[model samples]
Target: MDKYKQSLSTSTRPFSQPFCRRLMKPRINYKNISLISRFISQRGKILSRRVNKFTLKQQQLITIAIKQARILSLLPFIKFDII
Candidate 1:
């Protein structure tokens, strides 16, 4: 199907998401819970690189930071919704 072909083409392409050309790299800190929350799901799950569009290194850093934040009580391990 057209969708499947398009997905394959994109996967082969370099840099699926926009890459920063800056000399300095962005810092991933556990203390920045607000920013880290963007990479987490509503159920307190860390999103994958495919969904977040982050490079492998960045994704690893995010996962580590999220785990650290959770241990420190900055981020929650599980989210409970009030229905």
Candidate 2:
């Protein structure tokens, strides 16, 4: 029960209440404002989700490979960047 309540607020106490409405105004105006940046942000999110999934798949592959051989580096052998 305590954990559930804590999860509701988390670290956002400073910007709770009235400021929350103000913070959301920019997102509400995204359709009219600088459309290019919004496109970039949406694309960036899609790219990040793909990369995270790829990294998890890589870790699973590496674990299986380690079982067969003794050599596996955690660094990316394939191209991936964190945005």
Instruction: Name the best candidate (by lDDT).
Output: 1
Candidate 2, 17-71: lDDT as tens digits: 3223444344333133232122223323212323323344333432343232322
Local accuracy by lDDT, each model = 0.80, 0.34
| lDDT for 44 (candidate 2) | 30
Shift in Å, residue 79, candidate 1: 0.5
Candidate 1 residue-wise lDDT, 8-27, digit = tens:
87866464644452521455
How far off is residue 6 in model 1, in Å? 14
**Leading candidate by TM-score:** 1
Instruction: For candidate 2, report its TM-score.
Output: 0.21
Q: Model 2, 69: alpha-carbon shift in Å?
A: 0.9
- Tell me how far the alpha carbon of residue 21 in candidate 1 is from the true structure, in angstroms, after superposition: 7.2
lDDT of 1 at 24: 13
TM-score of each: 0.73, 0.21
What candidate 1 gets wrong by more than 4 Å, as runs, is 1-15, 18-26
Whole-structure CA lDDT of model 1: 0.80
